[model samples]
Target: MSQPVIALFTDFGVSDPYVGQMHARLVAEAPQARIVDLHHYAPAFSPGPAGLLLEALVPHLTPGSVVVGVVDPGVGTARGSLALATDEHWFVGPDNGLFASVLEAREGRCFRLREPEGDGLSVSFHGRDLFGPAAAALARGDRMVLGEEVAEPVRAEARRDAVLYVDHYGNLMTGLVPPEDGGARLRVEGRNIPFARTFGEVGPGELFWYRNSLDRVEIAAREGSAAKRLGAGTGTAVAWIGGV
Candidate 1:
C-alpha cells in the first residue's frame, strides 16, 4: 500500500514555533505517515481567503491524502472543529469558513472533531493540540476521534472576484479563473492588468495577469512586486475588464 500523506496548510508563519509543534505532534502520533508542507504563510488570521486558495489546491494533491489546516483565529473560542471528507482528500480544521470553498467544490461528508475529556490541550494552539492529533488519527485510518456528522459547514467568505493571497514575490492570486483569451484583462486597485502567458511575455518590470499553475488568476510584476506596484493584498477587490 502507498504511504499515508498528511499535508499541512496554515497561517502560522515560519518565524514562530507553532508549525514545529504541529510537526512534532504528527510525527509522534502518525510516524508511518509522510508529512508534506503545503504552505505556512496563508494570509495570517484570514481563513476565508486561505480556504479559497486551498480549494484551488485540492485537485493537485494525491488521492486520499489528509490535510491539516490551521488558519483559525478563533482557536480558543466557541467555534467548532471540522473534518471534511472529500473524494480526493480529507480536510481537518476549524469551522470558521476555512473549508467552505472545498465543501462547495464537491459532495463531501463533514464530521465534528470530538473533544478530549481531559484539560491537557492548550486553548490558543488547537493546531498542535487538536488538529494535529486528529489529522494523525485520520492518517492512520482512525475516525473514532471524529464526533457527529455536520450537514453544513460555514459558507466560504472568500469571493471569487477578490485577491485571496499575496505571495512573497508579491504575486496576487485571485479566486477568479482566467479566460482562454490572452486579451482578457483584470482590474484591481484602480489599475488595469493585462494578461500574459508568462513573465517573459511581458517586458521586465511590467505588470500583468496570467493563469497561474493552480488555475487561478495571478497578477505579477516581472523583476518587481505586484503587491507593491498596485498597493494590493488579501481582500483587494478585483473586477473583470472585458466581461471575462
Candidate 2:
C-alpha cells in the first residue's frame, strides 16, 4: 500500500505564512507526507462558498486521502474541533457544523475523533496543534479512532446568484437559466424577462437567461448590466419556471 494523501483547505490566503506553518508541522510530524493545497481563498467567513468548493472537490480525491478543511468562523467558541475518518477520506476541522456536514452529505461513511488520552492539546490554534499533527500521524500508518455515522449533518444549498462575480468587462454575471429541453424562457422578481444566446440575438437592453462556460444559469443584459438594472447580488433568489 502507499502513504495517504493529506489535502488542506482553508480561508488562510497564500500571502501569509499560516498555510506554510501548518504544512511544516505536518512534515515535522510525518517526514514523508504528501500535502496538497486544495484552496485557501474561501470568501472569508462564508462557509457557503467553502462548502461549495469542497463538494466539487471531494468526490474526485484519492481514496484514503485525509482532507483538512478549516473554515470555522465559530472556532474556539464552544464548537468542537474534530477529526473525521470516512470510508473514502478523512477530514479535520473545528466542528462548528460547517465542513463535515457538507462532506458527509455526499459520502457513505464517517467517524468523529475522540481525544487520545494523555496527548498534549492546544486550545488556541487547534489547526496547528491538533489537526495538523493528527493528520500527519494518520499518514504514517498510525491507527486512528473513528467517530460516528451521523444521519443528518448540516447542509448549504448553492443557489443561483442574482448576479455572479463581477467580471473585468463590467458585464454583470446573472443567475439566469439556459436552454432547458433545448429551448429557453426567463422570469425574475415576478416579471418575465427576454431570452437570447448573445447580445445580437436580442434587441439591445433586453435582459435574458443563459448558461455560461461553467454551465451555471446566468442572467445578463443583451449589452449591459442586468444587476445594476435589476438590483441583485450573490444570494438573490432566482427562478427558472420554464423550458423548451
Candidate 3:
C-alpha cells in the first residue's frame, strides 16, 4: 500500500511553536507519512468561514490524504475531538464545525477521538497533544485507536455569500461559486465589481471579480489590495449580479 499523505490545516500561525510542535509529534508518531502544510492562518478562531475555505480547497488536496484541521475556540472545554473518514480523505480535528463543509459535501463517518491514556495531554494545546497524534495514526492506517463512531458531527451553516478568506494579495475569496457563464459581476460594499479573465484584463488598481482556481468567486484589485479598496475582510457579504 502507498503511504498516506498528512495535511495540516490550522489557525496556529507560523511564528509560534505550536505548529512546530505538531510537526515534531507527527514525525515521531508517523515517520513514514508525508506531511503537507496546507494552511496555518485560517481565519483565527472562526471555524465556519474556515470550513468554507477548506471546502473550496478540498479539490486541490492529494487523494486519500489525511487532513488535520484545528480551528478550535473551545478547545479546553467540553467540546469533542473528531476523526472523520470521507470518501477520499480522512480529517482529524475538533468537532467544533471546522469539518462541517467537508462532511456536508462528502459521504463520511465521524468518530470521537479517544483521549490519550498516559501521556501529558495539555488542556489548551490539544492540536499538538491530541489531534496531531490521532492524524498520524490515521495516516498510518490505524483506525481502531480513534474511539467510537458518531452518528452525527456538529455542522455550521455553509455561507455561500460571504468572504471566506483574504489572500496575501488582499483578494477576497467568497464562498459563492462562480457562475457557469462568463460575464458575472460581484456587488460588495456598495461597489459593483465587473468580471475579468485575469489581472491584466483590468487596469492596475482596478477592482474586479473572477473565478479563482478553486472555482470560488474572488474579488481582487489588479496590482492592489481588494480588501482595502472594498473595505472588506473575512465574513464580508458579497452578492452576485448579471450572470447567466
Q: Model 3: per-residue lDDT, tens digit, 61-126?
A: 989889999999998899988998888888899998999888888898999999888857898999
Clashes of each: 0, 7, 0
The better-scoring model by lDDT among 1 and 2 is: 1
Which regions of candidate 3 are displaced past 4 Å?
242-244
lDDT of 3 at 34: 88
Q: What does candidate 2's lDDT look like per residue over 1-244, in tens digits?
A: 3766888888888898888889888989877778888777654665665555465567677778878887767655766555655667777776654464356455444445555557455555666767777778778877564456455445444443444344433344443335555345555666666556656787777777665654446667767777776665455556555544
- Clash pairs, model 2 backbone: 111-147, 112-147, 112-148, 164-173, 174-219, 176-218, 176-219
**Residue 148, candidate 2: alpha-carbon lDDT:** 60
- RMSD of each candidate? 1.3, 5.0, 1.3
TM for every model, in the order presented, reads 0.96, 0.66, 0.96
Give residue 72's lDDT in candidate 1 (0 to 100): 88
* Model 2: lowest-lDDT 10 consecutive positions: 168-177
* Predictions in order: lDDT: 0.89, 0.64, 0.89
Model 2 TM-score, 2 decimals: 0.66
lDDT accuracy of residue 13 in candidate 1:
82
Where does candidate 3 have its weakest 10-residue lDDT segment?
A: 235-244
